[model samples]
Target: MINRTVIVGRLVADPELRYTPNGIASCKFRVAVNRPFKNEGEQQADFISCVAWRKQAENLANFMKKGNLIGLEGRIQTGSYEGQDGKKIYTTDVVADSIQFLEPRNSTGSTQNTPNYQSSTNTGGMYQGSSQGQYGGNTQPNYSRVDEDPFANSKGPIEVSEDDLPFD
Candidate 1:
C-alpha cells in the first residue's frame, strides 16, 4: 500500500513555476535518470515528470536549472484526461515531498545561461536564495565571521602513556 519513491538525477530543463488561482505556488520539471546498465553499449535514460508545491516549489524553480543534480523523495501519481483530439491521455508524475540539491551552489553543469542560486539554511529551515528576475524580492542572509579559535591558547600535543592505548 506504500507509494513512496526516491530518485537522484539531473534536470532536463529549468523548472517552471506558476501560481494557482488561489495564489498557491506550484512547480513542474523533468529529470533525466540514467540506467545503471548499458543497452548495446549505449547508456539509457528515463525522463520523469515531477511536481512540487509551496516553498519547495518556489525554491526549486528559483534555484535549480537544467544539468543540476538533485535528489527527491515523493510518491508516484497517475491521472488521465480527455485531449482535444478526443483521445484519453494518461500522465504519470512524481509529487515531491522534499528535494535536496546534490551539488554545491556553483557546480551547475554546462547550462551557463542558468541563473546563479545560492542556498542557505535559514528562513526557518527552508532553503532560501535570491530570486532571479523570474521571481521577485531578494533577502540576503547575514553571515558571521569566526576570527578567534578556541584552541589557540592550547599547549603542544598532550603526552599519553601506553596505558591509554586500548590495543597494541
Candidate 2:
C-alpha cells in the first residue's frame, strides 16, 4: 500500500497554533487547492487541512498568512470524535512532513517590515534583499553518484514476502 500525497495550495485563513500538554508545538491550518477542471467558467477549490509540528509549526505561524501559497507533502489521515455539539465529527487532514513558502509576504515588502528569513549559507548576517541571497551556493545536497557501480544488485524492484513488508 502507498500512502504518499503532495499538494500545492493557498492558505484559507491564518493558522492556529497551540502547545500540547507535553509542550510540543502544533499548528492547524486550511489550504484552498484549486480543481484542475473548470466548471461553467468557474474554478473550483477544495479546502484541505494541514498540521505542522515543532519548529515548522512556529515558522508557519510567524510567516504564513491568508492567501499565501504553500507547498506541502504528507499523508492523509481520517478519524472521528465527538464534538462540542455531541455529534461525531469525521475529519481528514494531512500530517505534514515538509512545508515550504511558495510566495512572498506583502507586509515584508517594505524596508520597515523587512523579511526575516535566515541568510542562506553565506553573507554573514546582512539582510538579503529580493533574490533572498543565494549566498555562496545552493542549499540542497549534491547527489553525485561517485561510485563505479551505483546499483550492482541482481534484483530490480523488491517483491518481498508479506512478513518482510510493513504494509499488507
Q: Which candidate wins on lDDT?
A: 1
Per-prediction TM-score to the true structure, in the order listed: 0.66, 0.63
What local distance difference test score does each model get? Answer: 0.74, 0.67
Segments of candidate 2 deviating more than 4 angstroms: 107-168
lDDT of 1 by residue, 54-98 (tens): 677888888778889887777788889999999999999987766
Instruction: Please report the candidate that would top TM-score against the real structure.
Output: 1
Q: What TM-score does structure 1 among the candidates reach?
A: 0.66
- Quality of model 2 by C-alpha lDDT: 0.67
Per-residue lDDT, model 2, residue 128, is 25
Candidate 1 accuracy as lDDT? 0.74
